[model samples]
Target: MAISIFGLLEVMLLFINAVAILNEERFLAKIGWGRQAANPYEQESVKARIVNLITAVSTLMRIPLIGLNIIVILYLVVLG
Candidate 1:
């Protein structure tokens, strides 16, 4: 029972790690795309603001996911 549970835990950890890695990659890609996007209205400050805006929103959204992931990891460890 415990061994199966550990396997499940490993899978979950891999999933979360993949999600985190994907998110980071997506974040970088978005930043690069945004930088290259044509926009006459985008001044230096506006570009900075847009970058920060995207990052802030993404970070805020990811906070709960990360917290839940941590909780699950802890739960699995304690379950052992």
Candidate 2:
């Protein structure tokens, strides 16, 4: 149960971090993901891709976690 809670927290952190990265240029640059481009369009393109990747990974991790939580809840309710 503790581990499951920890996993949920980790997933939540990932989502929060991803949002921060998307919203803050300085934060993204601090992590070296904010790239310098010759044009504004190119810079936006790279930034969007990086943000999308982070969002995808976090969402993918979350799906399995949600399933695990549902399974655990069902088990507890049905068994006890």
Candidate 3:
């Protein structure tokens, strides 16, 4: 039962991660493929900063999620 619950949580996290990645790509497209603008100020605008932060956070989330997923898979294969 606990394993099943954890598996469900993992799936939810994976979905959230996918959505975050999609949003990041969308934001980057809106901002010109993450290119730096000619105007320095434009390069550091609020939208740009928010996108950067989101990228960083989503990247960080990926590492742990991948690790957790591997652990869960191994657990199921070895003991399920």
Model 3's TM-score against the true structure: 0.43
How many collisions between residues are there in candidate 3?
A: 0
- Counting clashing residue pairs in each candidate, in order, gives 0, 0, 0
State model 2's lDDT.
0.57
User: Which candidate's TM-score is highest?
Assistant: 3
In model 3, the runs with Cα more than 4 Å from the true position are 1-4, 26-56
Could you tell me how far off, in angstroms, the CA of residue 14 lies in candidate 1 after the best superposition? 3.9
lDDT of 2 by residue, 31-74 (tens): 65544422456645766677556556555655665676576568
- lDDT of predicted model 3: 0.65
Best by lDDT: 3
TM-score of 2: 0.29
Which of 2 and 3 is ahead in TM-score?
3
Model 3, 14-54: lDDT tens digits are: 77667456553457667664534324567577766755666
